[model samples]
Target: MKTLYIVRHAKSSWKYSGINDIDRPLKKRGIKDAHLMSKVLNKMVDKPDVFISSSANRALHTAVIFCENFGFPHFNLQIKRQLYSFSDGYLVKTVNALDDGFNSAIIFSHDHGINTFVNEFGNRPIAHVTTCGIIGLKFKEKHWKNIRRGETFLVEFPKNHK
Candidate 1:
């Protein structure tokens, strides 16, 4: 079985002047939320074997917090440039290209694309993925290449908690 954890980047700070969207940092509430989500993830029965994230600052920062709370080394993270503002197809391709050794993986990225990606492959009909939210999917296949649409067995988000 394969498990995919899709997480949207935490809320970003708009305090910086003329800052690029990719360079935006997380807001105070975002940081707190990320930590809370991380704690929740740490209690999961299936921990991710790999961490994949966009190179964007906010996404990368959110991934870092998850790594810290989950006791995973930062060096294990794989920053994929294509993850930044990529389409749902691109995101799915990226995921399907991941190493087969990874039975479980975590992907941290933005909205719209993230929402589309999950909705396309997962069992749920997700319209939006809020900041610091997580969507978990379990596939019956052993490899990413075998993953297909409507194969998800589970779905979850931080917002669903409270």
Candidate 2:
């Protein structure tokens, strides 16, 4: 069995002048929410073996907070450019290429793709995946290549708690 944790980057700040969308930093609320969600994840499951994130600054920052709070110091995170503004097909391909040695992995990226990826694999329609939202999926397959639609055993989001 394998597990995939899909997380959308925390809320980003548009308050900064002349900041590109890809370089936008997390808002104050985003930081707070990241910490909260990290705590929730620590209580729910063991730390993931791999952390993958989009190259975007917001996504990278969110992944950092999750790693710090979970005491997962090993930064084997890969910044996938394809994940920057890709569709669900690209996201799925990225996941399917993960190393089989990793029993669990975490992916931090943007919306739409994250939302669609989780919904497709989990066999459920997810509304907006708010900033800092998380969707945990348990798959029966050992390799990412074997993951298919309706193979997920769990799906969750941070908003569900509040």
For each candidate, what TM-score against the reference?
Answer: 0.92, 0.91
Error of 2 at 46 (Å): 1.1
Report lDDT per candidate: 0.85, 0.84
Regions more than 4 Å wrong, model 1: 150-156, 160-162
Q: Which candidate wins on TM-score?
A: 1
* Tens-place lDDT digits, model 2, residues 1-162: 888889898888998998787899999988888988888888988989898889899999998999889887745667787888757877898899999999999999888898788878886677777889888888888788998764555555667665
TM-score of 1: 0.92
The lDDT leader among the candidates is 1
Worst 10 residues of 2 by lDDT: 149-158
Clashes of each: 0, 0
Show the colliding residue pairs in model 2: none
